[model samples]
Target: MSEKSTVPGQFTLVLHSHLPWLAHHGRWPVGEEWLYQSWAATYLPVAKVLRNLAAEGRSHLLSLGITPVLAAQLDDPHCLSGMHHWLGNWKLRADEASMAGNTALGAHEHRLATEALDDFETRWRHGSSPVWRELIDAEAIELLGGPLAHPFQPLLDERLRTYQLHEGLADAQHRVGHTPAGIWAPECGFTPGMEKNYDAAGISHFMCDGPALRGDTSLGRPVWDSDTVVFGRDLHVSYRVWSPKSGYPGQPYYRDFHHYDHASGLKPARVTGKTVAGPDKAPYDPELAAAAIERDVADFVATVRERLFSESERIGRPALVVAAFDTELFGHWWHEGPQWLDQVLRALPEAGVTVGTLADARDRGYVGERVELADSSWGSGKDWRVWAGDQVADLVDLNTDIVRLALDTLDKMRADQDGLRDPVADQLLRETILTISSDWAFMVSKDSAAGYARDRAHEHAHAVREIASAISGGQLAKAQRLAAGWAAADGLFPALDARRLGPALGGNDESGGGSLRNHAGPRGRRMDAEGPR
Candidate 1:
């Protein structure tokens, strides 16, 4: 028998890698800075850990979902070059910090910056496609695909949603040369009957927040009599590492993410205490951190071990425990995240725990009783409030208006042109996707960079309004010019076609023969924008 058959239960870690399209949009504080910082502090180290493990003959290590938008940016010429410059600038900042008499901060940053720059120069200089593709070929990970711009599916009209799903998978296939049978549905957002959509897209499994399962998150369940399985984030096991009040990252010895040495743009302090003010936090000590990481890893391994045995006995069978988190959390938010990741993976298997991706759980017969799932997301309050709340009511309404307008206009323009794809229509679709991204509304509801989120939403909306009006008024030349201008920034997924939003794509819509424009749903209309400032 395989190790999987002998183990008590299976644990799958799902790390969602996503960021809204940030290239050529903004740089400092929110835009490309978010990308570069995460790239330096998170992506580099995390990829290194995985690569190291794969070299050690580890297969089926974990499930990683790289959003189509983020994947595009990772491989984009502009982002690749920008990331190089950012890495160099980081080294310069470290030098400046040292020259200004902060020896510890400068030395630490210099080492980190040098390593990151070397990683980029050697492996990432060409772009991240080859990096991800290498892992995919190694079979060390199960790649989960997602929508092009990470829209909340429950809020999208069937026409656009179907199109977005297809195009997003296509983009992923183009990037990594593998079309995933699974998806990390943006925000784990789900509505009833979405299985048909997944089925049509050739997806075998997808994710959801734990509450969506209501009980027994130890197995993947087929939703509503469909073969498409749904795996839920086992929050009880997941929150142990990053929970607000008691996660491992909160321990005082870990590095503080919020306390930065402004002089050199480096974080120089440890999280001396959770409630302790930033200025009073103790200086970071690597020795303390090494001790903390070892303890955390062992504790996490024990936690999973306990949960697995408890769940299997409770359910009367071997169980499946899925711990899902944002990929950025490991390094960007929790500075020692990459180290913890490497150690945890090694520890779990050594503890006689079975480790595998969600796909392994499915194939190994970790299926449970089929049940109807309810609408849910891994958002604030565990519901749609964060994206559809009263605070973002305007965004919701605007999203509805713009989605309907963009689709209808594209449809009309296609009809006039004998069903050919129009450049103007494509750009309108791109802006619409960006405008309705869940990030914007999320930032607004959380009051983190609400203004930037609002501005991006309006900017895309303005572009949509402009392109749509131009087309409607028969100003094809002006509309073409505007599309070209917008493409300079909003261009991603060049293969994106406005003509693909067909009702005939087949997703169990009663109105399959009719346009998939009936977007009337439970909450307010749908919309999105970006930022935390």
Candidate 2:
């Protein structure tokens, strides 16, 4: 009997692409560089992979969640232009190395640099590629939407959160030319009552980690709360491709993530093993890594085929095995991830293991009804500890205090008719929303770029406090001073409306001192627990 005859089901893949709104915010360690690097390593390459697969007449299923913030950067004329310049600069830097180094090393450096430049230019040429469009059109990809800036849903000022979510959806529709059927919920952060807001906004489904589904680490069905389906990531299958320490990319033969050449500030080494560190690392060999990709892809395909058959037989239906991961993991961290992706897509069809997107699987009746959902995330241990850990304890406190102060200020401004048109109020609202951006806490927790994280968190906090003090003390002169500074900062959520937050804070008082606990239901109740996802 054929393997297809033995296996009873299909599998789905969902990839979420999210980065905080970093344009014009911070640049060096954590801000724009993060976006640019991901764009080069993961976004552009993955888009190319999808386009290539579709061209070969392979209709594989993949769900991609591109946050509104990231979309803005991608579509921004300045970012596009800057990206082009950056790639060109990279080529120049590589050339400089080629001229300075020994013949063999110089030649290798020159070749790799040329390849990088060629790939980037070819894919991003003319400021357009139907790569994203082609996948959407072919129905091979499903788009997941999120807020304008990825603020933590439960921690945000309720009205601002609603506006961010609504506007984010609208923005995505405008940019991509389609309203998404689901949302990626920032970091898959979901609260008990957020569903009502999602429902009002016309979102039909969303995704969360497996732990969110009754604490079980398996593929789960949709939750209660208004028929909006929830698809949980199947970590078991996902971890095989990328685990904390045991992922395929960590193999000694892969390109090293750390240990760049200090003088040139370029990566020139391969991961020898867990013990290899810094200056002692061996040279990278793309050729050797390519060989590893074939082996890993074969192993991955067999795992999926086996999973599909096992799940199908167990469930007595075509069960789906969803493998989800951060888009940055590919090409950026793994280096060989894109190659592995290409091989796996081709291998699945040959093995008769049908690959499909989340939407396709749902349409094929692969959904189940579950009422209870646990509070969870895809962070360490699949929980919220990372964002709320001791390392960022001060940030958590700062966010709480600032949010409270901003809410109070907004409430005061609304209560006084004179404050309605006051530029200070408007500025306060802007600072408040920006301050609550989920990226700050995330960066602090990860320590990936902690210095920038501290600066950003403190900067927003300073704005919030200064504005609040000015408005409260009737120091119009000083408030204006602070407002000028905020304007110079130039945050993205400038048009945030404090009135939208009114209902959430207990009444229409815009001074900002209302309890969200009072507003925790459909109308106002939906406003109670807005925090970062």
Point to the candidate with the largest TM-score: 1
| Each model's total of backbone clashes | 6, 32
Against the reference, the lDDT scores of all candidates come to 0.86, 0.71
Scanning candidate 2 in windows of ten residues, the lowest lDDT window is 519-528
Question: Tens digit of lDDT per residue, candidate 2, span 1-533?
Answer: 38554655677778878776677776666577777777877887788788878777767457888887777667666677777776666666666666667344446656645665676677565433245666788866788888877877754556677877887877766766778888888778766667777878887778888767743323446566576777778777888998776889888788888776656556777898788676787777778888899899989888888877776677666777888888889888888888888788888877787777777776777777665665556766555556566666677667767877876676666777653566677678777666667777787777777777778778877888978888899887999888877766543444444555444445665435422232222211123236332
List, residue by residue over 1-533, the lDDT tens digit for candidate 1: 36534568799999999998889888878899999999998889999999999999998999999999999988899999999999999999999988998888789889989999999999998888889999989999999999899998887777777888999999988888999999999988887778899998999999998988885699999999788999999988899997767898889999999998877789889999878999999998888999999998988888888899899999999999999999999899999999999999988888888899989999999998897987678887667777777788788878877877776787677777877777788899899999999999999988998998998999999999999999899898999999999999988889988777673334554333222132322343222223110
TM-scores, each model vs. reference: 0.94, 0.86
The C-alpha local distance difference test score for the whole of candidate 1 amounts to 0.86
